[model samples]
Target: MAKALIKYALTALLLCTGLAGAQAQESGSSAARKAVPKIQDGWLDVRAGEGQGRLPIHVSRDWSQAQPAVRRALIVVHGITRDDLLAGERAAAKVPSAADDAIIITPQFLIAEDVAAHQLPELTLRWGVDDWKAGFKAQAPAPLSAYAVMDAIFARLLDRQLFPNLQSIVLAGHSAGGQYLQRYALFGQGSALVDQAGVRLRYVVANPSSYAYANDLRPLAAGGFAAADASQCERVDRWPYSLSANLPAYARKPLDPAALMRRYLAHDVIYLLGEEDKDPHHPQLDKSCAGEAQGDSRLQRGRYYFAYAAQFPRDAAFKQRLFIVPGVAHNSTRMFGSSCGLAALFDEGRCTTEVAAP
Candidate 1:
């Protein structure tokens, strides 16, 4: 009987020990997920207020030097993960032709936490993680809007001496990055610089959680859309969701909704939507009342925005198009690496253009 009791005690102790170990491992993983990401090495110096600020970036070529052979430039923005290096590498790989004649650049927009974690220099520009994606003002180095950093990057690319033969520029992003590009498409002033430089500019937006509607319209459940009821969702038309209010300093200018709509519809923008990105419960999916007002999922929101924009009065040269890529989800790799992605980014493959059903 004593031996039996000893054996039972041993078994209980063993079980407790195992449970403790498992809990410890889970705790470690949770800490790791919350840990700050490492900062990138390469930097681009730009004007921040009266002084200069530095931004991290990964470039396929030495953009500082003249690359006469370069005819196209692709700028791939990282999503919420801010994995700029990997994003740049994957983007360059998607276009094999980029090896010889095109340059790929990926810019990293770090947040305050990243700087504090890495003991970064004071001149390093940092923003609120979410605000940066929305073109909001950076928190450090200066109150410069994140979009201004983009403007500086565009100015650098337009240097006639560096890329003498540069004929086109493509700005591509996925997920949160897509949100950035979408809002930028509506309010960003970089296109004017690219236009003045006589370089054709295009935007590739994929799988953004939500879109910035030009007006107050929101998707309805049964079919079509109706202007959002302000009493039900007061913040529905706010900036980054729509052009109604709280526009970032970089994007805030005197303009009416109708004029903004005209500018947006005239721009050449392509959307890449994963057919399988319909999970309404995806953790990263925006489920706020404002977000829900758009649609239930990324796929639905994208289609609704595309169709909504189409209803606006556009010029004969309306340039926005949507491509729904089959068998992809909220993944940047699959969304940007698919045939539709390839065609949209590099004009290399075929993409089935999607039109809103009548």
Candidate 2:
């Protein structure tokens, strides 16, 4: 009986040891899978206020082989419901792999399934009509705003001490991403963090759903309106409209066209619109915002904003440019890859086109 008991005990000990080995192996594998190359690609935690979350950042640079001063860094922001990894892959594929001096950083956002689930206060506050915070009190969590996430990413880049030879930083975004950057530029003015960075910030806004306010509508001269007639002056309201209602009562009441121009002039702002995106029935169209005051279509909205900017005091110095690319529609990869689309943002000579109100 003693011999049999000893045999059973030995077998049980061996079984336990085998299970322990398997668990250790599995844990090691998981760590290996998450461990990306620290040189070009890796994940870093971005501090959003006090909370922290991992933001995956992909970096590409080859300054060791190229002229130091020629090095340029670009941060690519993706649209809603889209992943930055996919966007970065598409962008990197289109550009020649031989371009060594440019460093592209595509940072991913913490967006989940529900759209309204993560509604940012900084954004909703712009549209005063809806108190989304109060209405969805239970759903509201201390989440990061689009701008906050951007700020965190920039801070992390500086902390990483990477891209030592970087000279310029371009903030490029498409569709909803463009919308976020537009507001970010306006809100970030004179902030100590951005001002001290010594980084030349330029914006490439591609086919955003909405745009900042230009100014109060002005009636075109009779000759100018002849083509469209009195209907041209008729007010139309549209979806994804400006946050006019949210403007503080004590704030600058009148919409100043010159001020708008001055804000845009501070940065290199370029708008790349898809010619095929003129469709009013496009699936992504924000019909409600477009239909409000001067409401017609996305094409018309773009024209109006462009014309209004032209009326600025420094209109000549701050000459605005817009690109209407053929055979593209509301897709960042398509817009950025097209000859006219990406060229419009990079090339000053080829990108410049007169903004004439239609």
Which one is best on lDDT? 1
Instruction: For candidate 1, give the lDDT of residue 48.
Output: 49
Q: Clashes in model 1: which pairs?
A: none
| Candidate 2 colliding pairs, count | 16
| Model 1 segments more than 4 A misplaced | 1-36, 48-51, 353-358
Candidate 1 displacement at residue 196 in angstroms = 1.7
**Per-structure clash totals for the candidates:** 0, 16
Off by over 4 Å in 2: 1-44, 48-51, 61-70, 114-141, 157-160, 189-196, 214-240, 243-261, 289-295, 313-316, 344-349, 352-358
- Residues 235-305 of candidate 1: C-alpha lDDT, one tens digit per residue: 56777777888888776578676778788888889988999999977766766556766777899989888
**Which 10 residues in a row give candidate 2 its minimum summed lDDT?**
127-136
The residue-by-residue lDDT of candidate 2 on 45-164, one tens digit each, is 434443444444565643234445434556776654434345544554555631555666776443222223433232221111111111111112333334555666566444324545
